[model samples]
Target: MKSLRTLRQAAAIVPIAMGRGKGRSRQALAERLGPLRGASTKVAQLLSARDGEDAGRALEPLPLARLLPVMRAAAPTLLGDGATIGAQGRRASLGQVHRAELSDGRDAAVKVLLPGVESDLRSDLGLMGWVGRRAGRRLRQRFDGVAVDDWIAALGDELLAELDYRAEAEAQGRYGRAVSSLPHAVVPAVIVAGDEVLISTWEGGSALADAVAWEPDKRAQLGEALTGAILHPMLTDGLVHGDLHPGNVAFREDRGGEIVLYDFGATREISLPARQAWRALLRGEVPAWDALLTLGFDAERLAPLRDRLDALAALLFAPFRERNATQIDGAERRARADALLGEHRMVPRLAAPTSAIPMIRTLSGLFTILGHLAAPMELWRVFDGADAPAPALPTRAPGKHVAPALPARLLVRSFGEDGRGVEIRLPFETLPDLEDLLPDSAREPIERSGVDLGALAREAFARGPIPQTLFDDVVEGRRVELRVIEA
Candidate 1:
């Protein structure tokens, strides 16, 4: 067993200082340890060494022994008597999740902060503020006409606010209620306590791989449901889930085809403009050229971004795009993302920007999972439609066994210029069937429906025209297709 002293020491080495560029520092720290054989072992030794006086001094406001008592007191309120505490897992940017049980005698989850975490967070924010000011001065040339200080300050404030479990609990409740009307979606109930501890219900479901292997159509359905329940709130409601990765979502059998969302510590409220950008991208309404320009991304980098976004879109829409629903597995999807990010040195870039970490992590995980499921591009139709309601789970019909049709030809067309078109395809067979896709609850009216493919195609063409000569040929027998003319 790892000693508490060692854990404390290891935690101390984490360098809680703000604005020091967490990405860069972590890399440098990793490199520094390379020359030392068994570096981790040595670090563990130092951490475990019993130096109670020193540890207490370093810990300052909070002591280690006090942690268990604090946790015990808070656990009952959050988890109730049915809850049993488990070993602490790794600490994340927000808090740690421990396996537990509910008062009602069901398995559950609990989140608690490290001793003095609140105070440490406050100090970290102050440091970040100072660092942000300095960085703003140095990067003035690069970020001309932008409010660097304000951006940095906002980031620090965001970090501080995130440390508050109470705030997160409130946000979770608000978001949960917003999507409560939608079926096939689950947001765990938030258990509130004084400022530090949080407890929530835990839902059990199969892994993505298992789901896809069992049913492809259901996998696609899950994708659509997730976008509406989670993504919609983030894009239209100005309340970002902040963490939309697969780990944060679980598949439960009892809920029918609904997804169970876990972890709410990193939830952030976005602005109207950010939401607009999100909506435009999801609908394929934002032209590639415009997206690059708006985000201030370099044109040279557009190819990679376009490729990734297209692939991700297809994955998100797997059910509607791919006929068989079979594609690459989770491992392959991860490898593809890793390769792409590696080629672009995205990891290094990710490390340099602290504020972008959550966003990048979320995007990376989301894209990877989508790719694994081989989701289709058509689901974007659902994402972009402001008024579309969630789809109603079809009632089981007598002897019902209808095979899904191949994706519409028009929906498969590329978005690029004449001759050089980007193919949009999703791997559908790799995902779980529709029956296993969503969590079951009393059926609710579909808050949103599928996308209007015809309107979407027209909009895509309007943003970036294909050659007029190629238009008639592509549009033949298709409800929507690229209309291009030869020069």
Candidate 2:
């Protein structure tokens, strides 16, 4: 029954993804994945960090009456006598957490896994695997067949790992001890663990989402704590809390803004080599192609571009390489990347490594948390030296660095055969949509001149929007100028 329901949900997502825009498709997929409640929903939740949607927001907690019996059964000894389990306080991907008061008068959070969730998740992954292969074959231009299999396999391993409560307890205990020196990081201690139930000391704090609206100084302080909480474990011990979403992490004003981390079920251990490569990438010391290799991209396919790889690397990683750079323009970077991949048609040649998927997922979640805080962090402080541990918060508040102001409009000027000047002005924001907005008459001439207006616009936008000529040359015997205007 579970497999059949997942099948229906999976099938429904296909048409929605094909018929709608990217944002709408993401919303539709999240809506469908929410109900499946296992590996399917886990993937949705991970992607929510990028899509700016709370995929798990709609998840309904299993009723206490339905879950209490399972908790008692899983840990009969722990639930016996004066221990009283209260209502469900949190709903997770695979389980629901309830507040419990033990006979010893200690407060605890009892997390009870839904019955047969492991088997159901396995079934869901199997079905999704089948779907992935079928879709990969049809969409051979965009997805590599083998890479698709590897990615799904990698995701399956990480998702299944979250089902083991014993493993979670161990990871949580290790992480708690690892961050003990950082007074601002709070990792709740594990009290007891059963096969399917994990009991930990009850923790109190407001969600990180709420912290976003606090004063700038407080938000910056919380951001520093969050950065430490996520980076320390990964850099020092290579153990990462895979799900650091706002719901899983909180802020305690009473505790002097300590970051309260919860939900350790998705923790992962990073390998030494992978950790070193990530540090190099973050420090902007390594080439883009090297980072790609670490990420499991196809070296053979990338070989053809070796002659100009450095130039390509500079274009791709300029934002990271520059020290004290304030803004990271992800959109423009993506557009240029799409152009490169489109021109080369190398999307299908890529490969996804099993070991790297979780690391990437961990970083994606961390950046999302940082984005929410929306404050300038002295990120370089995290790696002041080659082997530095996560450093103490800087004595000074985060510095304010202003980016160059964006241009208001784009001006396209051309001279007609009669020596008349013709001009077209477009809103600055429409630069990204330049490809679609151009008519055949104008686009054909630009294409003939071997100039890709879309890529040019993206690169210009990324270089910081100021008064600059985007394109200037003769197109079909007519002098043309395309530039962004400050006004």
Candidate 3:
């Protein structure tokens, strides 16, 4: 029966995955996945969160009709007499929350797993495992050392654990107690826990989306609170809140502007050594190769690219390395990351430790939240909890080679009469291969336009890797613009 359900769900998803256009298909996929309410929905949320898509934002709470029975069935056992579960509240991939009045007259938030969601999650994971095996094979051709199976299993384990509200309640308790020292941080106290339901103190706050209207000072305070709330526990105790989204956080201006955190189903623990090494990396010190290996890279696989470790580490930890109060540019970050991967064709070679996957997810969620808050944050200060200055860009210790910063990119964009066009972005390191890399159609036109590709590249290199327009011309009825950009 589970297999049949998995098949049916997979069948339903095929059209959306194989849809015709990127924009329409993504919207269709998001719309389709939002209501599924299982691990599948989480896939959409995580991907969209990373890419800055609105898919996760569009998730609608389950209608009360679908959730009320589950709450009522569990209410007697969990809440006891005189308690009442109220209207449907926020929705998550695995559960939905409702406001309630407990028997003791205390307002509470009741979180319950969606009906049959456990089975749904198992089935979805089985399907994902099959997909991962197929993808793993293709990936192996490119990256012989990538541990795809381990990654998929780790993800499956995290998602499945969320169905156990008993565990989530405990995780919330731990996180709550850990963050108690932060005055502006709030984690609702768990009132009761059952197999599928957890009731906690009902927190009152406006949605995180409401922060846009706040004064700059208020937003900065909120950013500091959020950073402290997330980092303090992770750094001090190695306990991490792995699932964070706008819906999972709230801002309470009424309560002296508390940052209310929710949904502890997905969490992780980092080893103390790993935490220390990561701290050093964040502080702009390059750790020893053994220390870096402990942070989840596959040692043998990383050896081939060891020469570029400083640059890779710097790029990966860019958020922490920056000293200024600035908002991260996700697109630029992505472009640089993509260029790095392309430069080394390192996608397959680079293996993330299974344990680090959740940490990566946790960081992705944090970055997303901080991005939306859009306040000038001295992130290092927030991380250090002091007026510590940002360390200089990472440099190798004496006698060790330091890889230069990742190169800037050259972007070539062309539009036809009907506005259809292609944009090619190449890392500056690829400049020597410019003619070979360009398609014949693009190459022919540029050559005919009397622009010497080799000379142009040499001139750009002579001036150093900086942003400048190299070529902008109308050739053979095509409007083409080529420029250097720092990614």
Q: What are the per-residue Cα lDDT tens digits for candidate 2 across 346-382?
A: 4423443445555666666666666677665555555
- Residue 427, candidate 2: Cα error in Å is 53
Give the per-residue lDDT digits (tens) of candidate 1, residues 1-487. 2244334433334452224446455434333322221223222212222111011112222223355466667765545454566654423344556667565676666666765555454444443334444444545443421234323333444455666788788888878886776787888787654567777766566655455564666677776676667666765576767655545666654456777776666676654544554455444454433432333232333444555655554443343334455455656655665665555534233212223335444554555556555554334444445534322221111111212333332112222212222222211221122123212210011112233333434433442321111111122222222222111
Q: Please, what is the whole-model Cα lDDT of each candidate in the order they appear?
A: 0.46, 0.64, 0.65
Which ranges in model 1 have alpha carbons more than 4 Å from their true place? 1-67, 75-94, 99-108, 116-161, 209-213, 292-360, 375-378, 387-487
Candidate 2, which segments miss by more than 4 Å at Cα? Answer: 1-4, 17-23, 51-53, 138-143, 291-297, 301-323, 329-349, 385-487
Find the 10 residues in a row with the least total lDDT in model 1.
Answer: 50-59
Clashing pairs for predicted structure model 3, backbone only: 143-348
Best by lDDT: 3
RMSD of 2: 19.9
RMSD of every candidate to native, in Å, equals 20.4, 19.9, 19.3
Model 3, CA-based lDDT:
0.65
